[model samples]
Target: MPLHRLLYTSEARLSDNASGADLMVESIVAHSQANNEKRGLTGALLYVRGTFIQALEGPLDALENTFERICHDFRHARLTLVDMSPASERMFERWSMTYLAQNDEPARLLVNRDLEELYFTVSTNAAEAMRQMRGLLLGEGKKPALEVV
Candidate 1:
């Protein structure tokens, strides 16, 4: 079956404390890695400046189900579907879910870009967001600690 990709941005409802937020992100990535692998999903997640931008690629049904779950999660609000369409191939195929946060080394690419501006313009620049996420994954040159077998 051909793959479909969905990109979205949402207001992150994480803990006020930095450490608490780190733990929450860790738990989220761990849970997502397991579930995404089982559902044949591959994607990258970027969390920075109180926002979440994720791109998920998989079978349509699985992608829809995952999006629905995200919509209902208390950790996210102001969910905006940035883009959804048939994709020629998966962008992050090796990983079930690659998590990138503001503190991660890969996120250094974001330092030069105005994330607050990106968040405001995301609906119109969904493709750019995806490209940036892919760039972050490739920039580090080291494989993520978590990958789908």
Candidate 2:
């Protein structure tokens, strides 16, 4: 039987700070990709300047269940979920997930810039979108992150 898939997208506003932003971003990207490789899930992360616009697609249940842990994760502030939909096309082919930053600079000095205002004004749904992604991965018998405890 073929597994059901879901595509989730999110935008978030975070507290402005130079410390931890870079490391958190790197860790999240690395973590997602690693998890994907282990589970064969596909996803991607995009950061514009200091804002996050991510897309994740995978099995239905695990993706949705992850939100419970994400909301608890609280690594960042003002997380918001913007889009959740079933994707007809897979954005990433092999990698469990791919991360892209929209910062004008691709290197450390540029990509490492700590301009938090870019996202602070944005909506807060990153966490919610993350939860949705988890549900997609886990599939069925899934509860919203808010219900997870």
TM-score between model 2 and native: 0.54
lDDT of 1 by residue, 41-86 (tens): 9998878678898899999999999999999999999998989999
Count of backbone collisions within predicted model 2: 30
Question: Runs in model 1 with CA error above 4 Å?
Answer: 104-121, 140-149
What is each predicted model's overall lDDT from 0 to 1? Answer: 0.79, 0.50
Write down the worst ten-residue block by lDDT for model 2: 140-149
Query: TM per model?
Result: 0.83, 0.54
Clashes of each: 0, 30
Cα-based lDDT at residue 136, candidate 2? 32
Runs in model 2 deviating more than 4 A are: 1-19, 104-149
- Please name the candidate that would achieve the greatest TM-score relative to the true structure: 1
The true-versus-predicted C-alpha distance at residue 7 of model 1, in Å, is 0.5
Cα lDDT tens digits, model 2, 1-149, are 12334332344444466446667777787887777676656765656554455555666566666544554555534456555556555544544766544443444332223223223333455444444334333333533212110
